[model samples]
Target: MSDKEQKSAYGLGRAARLNLSLEMLNEMANTGRPMDAVLSSYFRHLQDALERRDRRDLENRVRSVLLHYRRLLWWLKKIKLEPTMRAMLLADMILSENADIPQLEKLCNGARNRMDMLRKEEIAALKRLLGKEINHPDMSDAVQSECPDWAQAGLKKAFGETFTEELAALATKSTSDYRVNTLHTTPEEAQQSLASQGFKTEPCPMSPIGLRQSDAGGPILSETDAFRQGWIEVQDEGSQLVALFAGAKKGMQVVDFCAGAGGKTLAIAAQMQNSGHLVACDVHSKRLSRAKVRLKRAGIVNTQRVLLENTYDKWVKKSRGKFDRVLIDAPCSGTGTWRRNPDSKWSKDETDLSELVALQADIIKSANRLVKSGGRMIYATCSLLPEENEEQIENFLKENDKFTLVKAKTVWEENFETPYPCANEDYLRLSPHTNGCDGFFACVLEKK
Candidate 1:
């Protein structure tokens, strides 16, 4: 059979999947869009045409290439070749997918253009130099970790002795986690329902209501009855922990400040038991609208969506000192989510971090006004940087004497029956290496 006729283990033909993966990568570079968004739009029309297995294969191939994009480029550079998408994809096959080098050589030699074909000398070099290992002893720390130079220093400083371990965790594929919407069904019921539909899941260690797939890249849960029935929502365990830390109770007036797309808002509303008012506020009206749909699907009725012009909007002025709980899931560098969104690392820089830190500072100050005396304000970010996480909280505390830090460990003990895993003193800092969830930092401060 021709190479085009040879099917990959994931179900798509090798040649077809490779070419499509290259196209997707190029589109991501040209458009500056995320892989998921680009994939959705690229395959919108092909949804009906492609089988589920084929789609999964395509997604896996694209994700693998992106996950090791920097390393693949590094290998290509080491071989003294142009770092092209096609070249990187080949390197991914050899390094990540463990494809046979002889087969790759045969396939590339048959390509139409001379640029596409690997020369005999290049093939010999690939055989001599490349191995199953993506990282090399000679590689720079940044290249080995697949992060920018500036970020590598920050991550090293933040993680200290565990820097390599943290990088390994961040490099691995993200686990598929789902938070059981307690408003619709209990964790037991959700797990049972998913299991009945051929989806095997395990309870997340930290979150009581969280379930994760037994394996990576299971069929999309959106097609399952459990998701359709609102029994489960795709949420990281770390994020669910943040909502729990907020301590939203029945009949408590809460504000999900900066509630973009409202993932945490849904969790908070469920904890509120559909009683009292919950305001979901964001600068983007479209995100709030999307969250409205999720709220409805999750059977959350206690929440109302509010669009804000900025942190200092008229709504903030009107809602000052009114909420019992205010959650600011502020914008940041997204360093914590690098595993799930590897391309995001390259998209941002130190300048972006500085800007986000400033914005986060302004946001926390504005949102703090919504917290009534003795009420709690939860500041959260999916960033690993100190400037955006701990530093922001420290500055906020210095500026606002009325608000004092609440130990996350204390809240964890009060809320969860399970023992706290890590020893994060004042803040609830979670990393992929330590928490098996996305890197998240949440700090609770109460108004005196």
Candidate 2:
């Protein structure tokens, strides 16, 4: 078993878990792993540590600590703590789940330096001190929003100065929502089944196949028969919509060019009614293996999973100009996914984004070849930055003489029973404030 697996197998209390998380974060930050991926790794293990009945409580508390990390760091610094002291203070605060000031001071009373110093403060005044610090002009806007300095300018250029507030709100509450598996159950049936099993859910307004989930204090829906029987699969509504935009049809050839774990590929399978050839192709065979389980659970039989040697795979070259639809879920900075993985904002920068842009360009250039004449290819990323979204599509159109833009808004308006949520006419621009989902950009291009 992997080291991560071994860690999951061992038991740890809340404080110990927080310490492990901090150590892992420090190492991962050094190695340049995105906070979202790091947190996913950390939290999944924490889930394994708790009993099923107690899992939700531990999960909720840890999420709160992680979600407020920026504020916590700023708060620690404001109170005259050094860098080393800050990590210790943060761990104590996390163990207490950022409790009331008096309670927090009690938790820290045994600690040395700044934390011990804080225990001497008047109990009633600590919150006021916190407000004074976080409310200062230096701490407001992007700093207060927990977004990095370098990223704020681009975001302002995209959504104006007010985008900070929306971005900040998204940093909290990474709830578990699922997409209704239409191959097995209707949205209403799926919602009803979960409700019967003590889950609070409603049909997602934007995507017909989505279920916005709420907790009912029983086991998470993951442990329910409804899930095991393939009534639902955890998927963001933005993701469900991206699959919809691909427009797969029964008996048509489709390629999910970067089908990591087959999230979109399964959605596409339902669209195809399991009657056509659906290739779930990715560079990682491990992810494809995992995708196979989801495909089976989702009752998706028309799809075949393949490992790509690279963009220039022999299979891709041979299948050139054959697929009716090709979906490029390109790798990206994942700026749009900060709602669930707020730590990611700190890990990404222009240099990393530039590398991703080049890779995206390369993948699209090679993957587009699989689209037959007049077939649609959708270029997509879970990134709010234009450099990775609309700009990439614009540059691709310029470079590829035979491909033309397919206005996403028009397609959304005509194709769906409800109106599209975002205002961008030529490409998808889903965000937390507007769509109540993670940030995503998708644009369709058709080969001539």
Candidate 3:
């Protein structure tokens, strides 16, 4: 048996698990990697020393601490404790986990900490100090929402009356969503295949082929045979909806501009029934190259990958006015995906958002060249900021008199055969609060 299999045969104790969690927490603090990536890398070293249940609980505990990162830091500072990784973890346990002080102290005895070892008195004092202000009305909006100070104003502008509700939703745990590869299997068959392997999934409310894991328990899809056979790909429901909105019917030419890792490329190809000529283009050669395996695994043959030197690569000039549909999944601040990537909340700032807004505008101008007259251009972002979504579309329409905005609801109904949800008329806006998916904004523009 492999080390992982051997270790899985005899799981680690709670203390060992806690130590691993601390190690991951500290690595995240030190390395500035995203929580999921950090956890994935650390888990490999652990070699399944923890059981599935313990493994999930450990991930949840670590994620909870990071998701409530700002609040934990605020509480730590309030108690005059240095906001070290260990301190933040303890604060998370006390305030967020509501961990028993005595048991928490006992747990820490088994967990090893490289710095800032906590004494029993400190843990008790933290419980006392943090408990008193758990819901203190004086808490700042950023701390209370666990949102970054820079993002607060923009989110308020975007969400309006439901701002707090949206932030709470973003701070909550997100489940894995998968889009069934219609090329390989039907949603019904895929569900049956997954159920056979211990996955419990429910149909996604919006996308016909999308499935949502009922809970985090059961086997992760990546390890299942269904995934290896390309029956399912891990994609958010909102993302699947966006690809469907691209409306890439079979035999039509389509461009997935900015097709990072081919998430939407795969979705669009499947929608084409593997018969269309789809070009997956990205500025990063590595990201575009990685899509080869995913494409092959999905049994997709209609798509071709392109490595662009930049958005203005010579390929764009040659391909201008050729594509029937152009999909720009523009890179943005990713504020919409904060629920799945809590660390991003602190990592981005006003300057970064401004830069992304400018970049999106530039990319839209360049990629719009690829859409033929009467063909449509689909612009999308996993961003909550209006500057990146509505404003960019508005500006594009003003500059290019030949192009007019197409109501997203019209395209949504055409693709999904159902009335669009959420409020905006011109754009498809989805949020964790309103759509139970990641926050997404998509609008269609067609040339006259």
Given candidate 1, what's the lDDT at residue 49? 48
Q: lDDT of each prediction vs. the true structure?
A: 0.82, 0.74, 0.83
**RMSD to the hidden true structure, all candidates:** 3.6, 4.5, 2.9
Return the TM-score for candidate 2, rounded to 2 decimals. Answer: 0.85
232-332 per-residue lDDT for model 1 (tens digits): 99998988988887889999999999899999999999989988999999999889989989998989888999989877999898888999999999998
**TM-scores for all predictions:** 0.92, 0.85, 0.93
- Top TM-score: which candidate number? 3
lDDT of 3 at 237: 93
Clash pairs for candidate 3: none
Candidate 3 local lDDT, 1-448, one digit each (tens): 3465436432535655666677788787788888888887766666446457776877887877778788777777777787887777777776765676665656666323222345765765586654553445767876788878778888899988888889889988786899999998999999888989898898998889999888666776788989989999999998998899899999999999999999999999999999969999998988987899899999999999999888788999998899999999999988889888888887778898888888898899899999999999999999998888898988888888989888887888788866688777889999888999998999999998
lDDT leader = 3
Candidate 1 minimal-lDDT segment of 10 residues? 1-10
**Regions of model 1 farther than 4 Å from truth:** 1-12, 100-102, 105-132, 216-219
lDDT, candidate 2, 1-448, per-residue tens: 3555445533534444434444555655577776546656655655555566344443444455555566656655665444442343453353344345655555345322213335333343345343242334656676567677656766777788558666765775654668878888899888888888788887777898889876557666778878999888889988899999898888999999999999999899998888989999999989999999999888889999989989789898899899999999999888788777665666667788789999998999899999999899999999888888888888988888999998888778756888877776888888888878888888889889
Q: Least lDDT summed over 10 consecutive residues: which range in candidate 3?
A: 109-118
What is the TM-score of candidate 1? 0.92
List clashing residue pairs in candidate 1. none
Which regions of candidate 2 deviate over 4 angstroms?
Answer: 1-49, 52-62, 70-76, 84-135
Ranking by lDDT: 3, 1, 2
